[model samples]
Target: MIVGGAIFQLCWVVRDIAVAQQAFTEQYGVADWFSIPDVHFGTESAELRGVPTDYTISVALGYAGGQQLELIEPRDGVSLYSEQLERIGPGLHHAAWVPDDYDAALTEACAAGIEIVARGRFDDIGMEFAYLDGGSIGSYIELMRLSEEMKAMFDHLIPAGFTNPWQ
Candidate 1:
């Protein structure tokens, strides 16, 4: 296993987050999405292919069984999300994990020959993340480390019955 555990989230890139959310709710039984309509990943906060890049996206997050489901609508700027949406119009984009040791886990992935396509820190939320190339799998692998505050926020947003194991 790359991160040595179960995947916590699966994300899909889409043209419209609202439509995608409805489709997922109806087709895959995922309901109760917590949406953030405008998220700005500025050049100061993000990178693409090791170079500073900016992007904006709207996302709806929910749960499907035990895993978190994310639907992203690329709004502006060049990013992995936008690129994937262009290359393979609106579908599965990545599988993700929130490992306990972020740096160590990242180093291990790099040592294993997984290329780091992008990495950045969301200082406002005390979170850091990276996207690793999933060449053979035809998707990216996301590794994230969240702060206690962010975990608490997620816990609050999740429906009463759902769980966030990482939190």
Candidate 2:
């Protein structure tokens, strides 16, 4: 399995994306990166084996130093994020890592005893991601692999922002 990209970002699912964003700005001094609508898929679209489901949601992205923070809020039915929010009340939903070989990484994670919680694409970003069992790691882990077109889009869009953390 592929390794070594490092923790790329952290996500938090909240009841209200705007409220969470404000809280983050006040608590961590992070700035808003962007916000987008998203969808989740599963047996029932939002059902979790051990938690509740969080379906169609809105996410706000923010940046601090070299890491990103995502605030997710349900826009429709139940979803994984909604489940987390129900249990924990809007905080530290997951951590993300970038991998070159996503399939191989998933294989490795499974071999290492991590469950594949969900897998899907972010159409807006042209990227795909997988969420592994949080119970195993004490928190959820997300692995992202961006397509070439997505990388190009990010390269162009990110520079337009007020802060370029990677630089």
List lDDT for all candidates, in order: 0.87, 0.69
The lDDT, on a scale of 0 to 1, for candidate 1 is 0.87
**Regions of candidate 1 where Cα sits further than 4 Å from its true position:** none
Candidate 2, superposed: residue stretches over 4 Å from native: 38-54, 123-125, 156-167
Writing each residue's lDDT as its tens digit, candidate 2 over 25-100 gives 8998875558776645544322355454546778777767656667788777666676776787767888887776
lDDT of 2 at 142: 85
Clashing pairs in 2: 46-53, 53-78, 53-79, 54-78, 54-79, 54-80, 55-78, 55-79
lDDT of 1 by residue, 1-167 (tens): 45767677899999989889899899989868999998899889999989999999998999886678899899999999999878878899898888888889888988999999988788978988899999898799999999999888777766667677674
